[model samples]
Target: MHTRKEFLRNALVAGCAIPFISGKDFLAGARIDDFSFTSPFIRVGLRRTYPAFSFFATDSLGQGRLHLSPILTEPPRSKAFTARTYRDSISYFNSPEDIVADWQVKCEEKKIDLISRKPGAEPFEISFSRPQNHATVLGIMREGQRVLLPCILHLPGLGTFIIESRVPDATIFYDVTARESTGETPFVKLRFDGAGAKGTVKYSMRSVTLFPRKKKIHRIPLFDGYRRNFINIFQLNPRLGMLANSSSGDARASTLFLYAEVARVTPPLTKTFTAMDLIRDSLETYISGKQGYGHPGWSGNHESLDSRPSLIIAASYYIKSTSNREWAQKNYPAIKKWGEEMMRKDSTGNGLIEYGYSGNSGSWDSKIGPANWWHTIGFGHEDAYSNILCYRACSMMSDEKIFPQDEHTRACKAFAEKTKQHFFTNFYNPETGVLAGWKSGDGKLHDYYFTFVNSMAIHCGLVDKVKGKEILTKLLEKMKEVGFVDFKSGLPGNLIPIHPSDSGSKEGFQIYQNGGVSGCFAYYFIYALILCELYKPARELLLGMMDSYAKNEFEGKCPNTGMTRVWKTWNGECRGHEGFLADSYHALLVVEGVDPKIPFLNELVHFLNALTVS
Candidate 1:
C-alpha cells in the first residue's frame, strides 16, 4: 500500500481531488484554542490567537440556507498537511485552536489582527478587514515561522478568505476547501466525511499593492472575474457534490434544470471533488425521491416531471466524461431502475412520457408545481420541453459505455427511437413552423412559438438536420417580425404571448416565463445554430451576451422586485429572483466548450477567430 506521503506527493502535482483524511489526528498536539469569533456570515477559530486553525460558514440569503464546512486551515507540518514550507510560512493561517506560543490578538468593530513574537526579532502582525462588499479579500505578508499580517478582503456569499504562502524554492500550496450538508438525512444524503480541503472555492490574491513583492501568490478561480465568472456561478460544494443556483441562497443545489445546463461543461476543478461523486449523489437522490436534493432531482413530485431525463443526462455525462466503465459496471442495476421508472411514465404507450397534469387552459394553478424548469408555464401531458430531454436521455442511457448490453439497454434504445419517431408529429405546430410548448391532455396544441422548445429539439437531433435548420430560420424570421432585436438581453422564452389560463400564475407578458429572456435556455438556441454552422447569427448573439457578462449585467438584483437578474424583461427590466442564479451563465459554456484553435483567447477579433466566426 502506498503511504499517505506518497499520495500527497502525487496529488500536489496533479491538482487532483483531495481524499478524506483526519486533520485532527495529524495536528492534535499542535492545537491551542486561544481565540474565536462567530457571525451569521463568518466564523473564525485561531490557534494561539494567531493564523493557524479551522472554521465553518453558513449563510441564509433570503429564505434559502447553505452550509460550508471544513474551510481551509494551516496545520502545523504534520501527517495530513505535511508541507514543511507551508507550515513555516509567515502567512500560514490555520485553526483558531492551533496555539503557537507568544501570540497576541486585538479586535475592532470591523477588524481583528494577530501578532507573533520571538525574543530577539521584530514583531509580526497580520490583520483582516472584514467583508464589506459582494466578495471578501485576504491580505498576506511574509517574515519567518508564520505571522499574522492585517489586510482587508471581501468574499461573496459565505464567510471566506485566503492565506497565500510563497517559498522561493518551492511551490506554495494552500489547501482551500468547503464542505456542505442538507441538514436532512435521506437514505442517500452524501455528507462529506473527513477533512483536508473540501475544494469548493480556491481563494487567492491576484496582486497585493501593500506587500513588498507586489506579486500574486494564490491563483484562485474563487469568485467573479475568473473564467468569465464560471467559478462564481457553477462553483462546487462538497456536501451537495453540485453547484447551487447561487451562493446567494435563492435556490438550493442541484436543481435539475441547472444541473442539466451543466451537462456540456466538464468539471472545472479536480482538487477535492469529482463529477462521479456528483452524479452518484444525484442518482441516489433520484431513486430516494427526496425534496431538498434539488428540484426534479427527486422523482416523488408528480407536478415536476423532468426528474427522469435530468437524472439520466447527468449520469450519462459522468460516464462519458470519465469513461469509467467500472462505475457503469457497478451501478448498472440502479441505472436500470431509473430507466424503468421513466419508461413507466408512458402510461398510454404513445412513446411520450405523459405527465400527470393535463396542462389544459386554466388548469395550471390548482396543481402543485410547474411541469418542468420553465416553471412559470403550465406544461404537461406530452410536453415538448420534457420530451426533448427524454429523447436525449434515452439515447444516452443506451450508450455502450453508460449501460451494459443487456435486454434493458435494448429497451432504452427502443424507447429513444420510438420517442424520435413520434416526436415531430406529436408536437410540431405547422401554423408557426416551430414546435409548440406542449400538447395538453385535453387534445390541444399549445403553440406559443416557444424558442427553447424549438431550439432544444433542433440542437439534440430530435428533429432532422434539414428540418431543424428550416425551423430555426423561421423562428429567427418570427423573432424579427415580432420586433425583438436586443440579443444582449437574450431572446424571450417564446414569441407570441400565452393566455393566463395556460400559465402557472397570472404573470404579465415579458415577465417570468410568460415571455422572459434568460441565458439559461438561450444557450440552446445559440449552440443549436453553432451546430448547424450558422455562424453569423450565432456569433452575433454569442458576442452580445459576452458584452453583457463583461459588464456584469446577468447577475445582481433589480430595484423593482429585489430579484436577481438571472431572468430579465424584453426591455431589460429585471423580473426574476435568485440574485446570483448559476444557470443564468450557462450561455458562457458556448465560448468555453467550443475550441477554435486558440488558448484563453478573449479579444473580440481573436474570440471570433477562435470560433471561426467572420
Candidate 2:
C-alpha cells in the first residue's frame, strides 16, 4: 500500500492549480468573501456540474444555432462563449402564474390547447400528430416570434422519444437540418420518414435565443462596484460548487455573510447578495424537488417526488427569521401536501419521512448483504429526525396561519406521540442507552451506533440533556479511533466510517465505506456538535475543515478536495481547484455562533415587496 507521505508528495507534484485573478482585476471586482466579478443575470457559460455532458449557447432566431444535430457537440472555452449576454429564457423570476399568463398571451392563436401542467409525481409527456404538428404554434410565424425556445435533448439522463411530421409543416423543421453549410449562412431542411408517409415536420429545435429586451442584468451586491469584475471570475469557477461540497469549510463563508447581515439588516450586503440569495435559492431548490438534494441524485434525471421534510423544516426556520409571512403561506401548502404524500409510511399509519431512494446504495440499488438490506428496507431510521422536522413545520404553519390552529396543534401532538412511540419503543437500544441507526425488517435494532442516528435523536429533541452529552462524547471517540483525521488535522477525505462496534476496533472491515469525512455531513455534524456544546472539539473539527481548503495564497477560497488536495479518490487524482456553496453555507452556520446572521432577510423583503406590487 502507498504510504500517506508518498501520496501527498505525488499529489503535490501532479497538483492542478487555478490561476489567481490579478490584483488590478482583483481590486476592480472583489466580493466580500472571494474573487468573482460577474452578474448573475448574464450567461457566463454552460457547464454540467456532473460530468458526461456538454453545454453550448444559441440565439433564438436560429442564428448561432448549433449542437442540434444527431452527434452531441462540445462547448468551446473561447472568450466568445464566456462573454456575458443578456439572455433571459430559462429564468423563472416571475411567479408560475405570471409565466403561465405570459405563455397564454403568446400562444393564444395556436391550434394547441396550450395548457400549463405542473410535474407532480407523474412525468410529463408531449406527443404531436403529423397534421397538427406541422401547424405553427402561434399566429406569429416561427421566424417572426420574439420568444426563444431552448430545445434541450439529453442523450443520457433523459430517455428516448419518437417524432412524426407531415408536408404542410415545412416551416417546422428539426434543428438538426440547420447544421449543413449552405455556402454562406448555414440552414438545415426538415424531412421525416414515418410508417406510411414522409414529409415536412419540425419536431425539435436546437437553439436558445435569450430575449435581451425582457431580460435585465442584475448582480448580488457581494462586493463594491470597483471589486466586481474580480468577483465575477469566481462565480464562473466550479470551485464555489465544490466549496458547497467542502465538508465543514462552508462555515467560514456563511459566517461572513451572517456577520454582514447582522451588521446591516436594511439594505443588506449591497455588495454580494449571494450569501442570502443562495440560502433562499437552496431552500427553493431543495423544497421544489426540481434540484437534487438527497444522495444518489434524481432517478433518470426526473425530479424525485420524495420530499425531504427536514429541508422544508429548515427552510421554515430560514423563512421565519426573515419574517416573510407571505412566502411562508405560499410555500406552506405545498410543503404540507408533499409531506402528506411522499413521506414513508410508519407503523401508526401516519406518514414517516425517509431519505434515500433507488441508487442510494446497494440496499436499494443492488442486492447487498442481508444486514445492509434490513438496515435500509423500512421506515424505522427515519423516525425522530423526520417527525421532529414535521413537528417544526406544523408549529410554523400554526404560527403563520397557514393551517388551522386546532389542526396544527392536533397534528403536532399526533406526530409527537408517534415519534415517542416509534423511537422509544422501536429504535432505543437498552444495552447502549442510545438509538440504533436502523430497526431491521424483523423490528429488532440493526444494533449499530452511528453519529447520525444520535444526531437525529438530538435534532428531534428525543434525548435529554445528559443523554445528549453522552451521545455526543461517544460520537467524538468513535471518530478518533477510526483514524478520521490526519496529523495536520485535515479530514481524511471521506465520510466517517460507520464502525461495526463501539470500540472502533478492526473486528471487521465491512462497515468502512467512506471513513474519511463528508462535506455535506459536516454541515449538520458541526451543528450537532455546537448544540451539544462540545466547544473545543467542534472548533477543532471546524478549523481543521477550513484549513484543508486553505491555500497559502487566498484567505477564503476552499480546495474542491478535502483531506488531501486531490479532487477525486481515484489514486488521489486532482481535477479542479475551487470552492463551493456548501463551504460558504456551512461557514455561515459556524460563524453565526460567534455572531448571529439573518441570511437573505432583504431578499425575502424584496420578494415580498415585488409580490405586493404585482
**Candidate number achieving the greatest lDDT relative to the actual structure:** 1
User: What are the per-residue Cα lDDT tens digits for candidate 2 across 255-349?
Assistant: 22222222222222212232233345445544554433232232222222223444445455556456566776677666566545433344336
Instruction: Give candidate 1 regions above 4 Å deviation.
Output: 1-226, 235-242, 248-277, 284-289, 293-303, 559-561, 595-614
Please give, for residues 1-614, the per-residue lDDT of candidate 1 as tens digits. Answer: 75533432332233222222233323332344324443332334445433344443323111111233333444354422111122222222233344332333333222333333322212232221111112322222122211122222223333222232221221111111122255321111111111123211111222111111101211211111223244334433323323345322322322454454454454422233333444455555545554443254333256355656777777777777767788777776776787787788898777898887788888767334656777667787888888887788888888886666778878989999999889999998888788988889888999988888998898788887789888889988988888777787677888878887887667788887778887777778987787666666776677566556544567656665666676788888888755455667677666555444532223333433333322
Overall lDDT per candidate, in order of appearance: 0.53, 0.32
Each prediction's number of clashing residue pairs: 38, 52
Q: RMSD in angstroms, candidate 1?
A: 14.8
TM-scores, one per candidate:
0.64, 0.45
User: Can you tell me which runs of candidate 2 are displaced by over 4 Å?
Assistant: 1-297, 300-306, 342-344, 347-363, 367-388, 398-409, 431-433, 485-513, 552-588, 593-614
Instruction: Supply the TM-score for candidate 2.
Output: 0.45
